[model samples]
Target: MYTTVELVRGSSKLADEKAMSAADVEMYIKKAQARIDARLKKRYRVPLAEPVPDIIESIATDFAAGFAIEKYYSQRPGKEEPYLAEVLIKRAEADLAEVLEEHLLDGLPGVEFLPPPGPAPAVLARPAMQSTTPVRSEMTAALERW
Candidate 1:
C-alpha cells in the first residue's frame, strides 16, 4: 500500500515537480491507479492489489507523477513546465512497456547457451603408412658361442 509520502516522493523526481503537495500527489495516484491496473493486467501477470511489485509500482509512480504534473501545468502554465521537457510521460510509458514486455520474452523457447570457458582441445592423429613403424632403443641380442 502506498502511503501519502510514498506516492509523492516516488514520482516527484520523475515529474520534475517539487512544489506539489502530498495531497495533490495522492489524489492523482489514486486516480491513475485504475488505468495502471488495467494496463498492467493486460501487459503482465502480476497482481494489481496493494503491496505491488517494485517494478510495477515504479512505473505506476511515474505515471501518477506525470498525470499530476500535466494537470498542474494545465492549471498553471509556465516556461519551465515538465510538459515542455524532452523526456515526456510518453517516453516513460514506452520504457516501462519495454521493461514489462521482457517478462513475456523470458518464457519463450529458444534460449541461448553460453560458449565454453576455454579453448577447444586439440586433436591428435596416427601415421597413415601401412608398413612403417618407428623403432625404439632396446637391447635384445642373443649370446654367441666361441
Candidate 2:
C-alpha cells in the first residue's frame, strides 16, 4: 500500500507544496480512506469491517494527497486561478472512480451470494374441492366490507 509520503509527492505541485505539511497530509489520508471505505461498503457487498485492501488504501491515499494540495492552493491569498485546484480535485475523484470500477469488475474478495433468506415453503397436496374466491389485499377486502 502507498504511504502518506507517496501521496504528497504524487499530487502536490511545487508551488503548493509549501502550504501542506506531512501532518496535514496525514489528516487528509484519514479522511480519504473513510470516504473510500464508505463508498466501497455502499457499492460492493464486501466485508469492510476488516482491514482495508492494499489496492484500495493506495488509491485512496494518492487521491487524498491531490485533494490536500488542491485545497491549499484554492485557499491561498491572491489566488490567480481557482480552476487549477478544481481541476486537480476533479481528476483525483475521477481516478478513484475508475480504479474502483475496475476492481469491482474484477471481483471483490469476500462478497458472495447467500442462499435465499428464509426456508423454502413445503409443498402439499391440495383438497379436491376448492373454494372459488378472489384474493385481494387486506385494504381492498376491508373497503369491500364497508
Highest lDDT model number: 2
Any idea what lDDT model 2 has?
0.58
Model 2 Cα shift for residue 124 (angstroms): 24
Per-residue C-alpha lDDT of model 1 across residues 87-146, encoded as one tens digit per residue: 445765775677556763243333222344565544435445563446532432223321
> Cα lDDT of all candidates, in order?
0.54, 0.58
Error of 2 at 3 (Å): 4.0
State residue 93's C-alpha deviation in candidate 1, in Å: 1.2
lDDT of predicted model 1: 0.54
Q: Which ranges in model 2 have alpha carbons more than 4 Å from their true place? A: 14-18, 43-58, 77-82, 100-146
Q: What TM-score would you give candidate 1 relative to the actual structure? A: 0.50
lDDT of 1 at 45: 41
Model 2, 1-146: lDDT tens per residue? Answer: 22465555565553344666766777777777666656656455443434555556556655676567566766567554345545655665776687566764244444433344565444435446754667766887799999
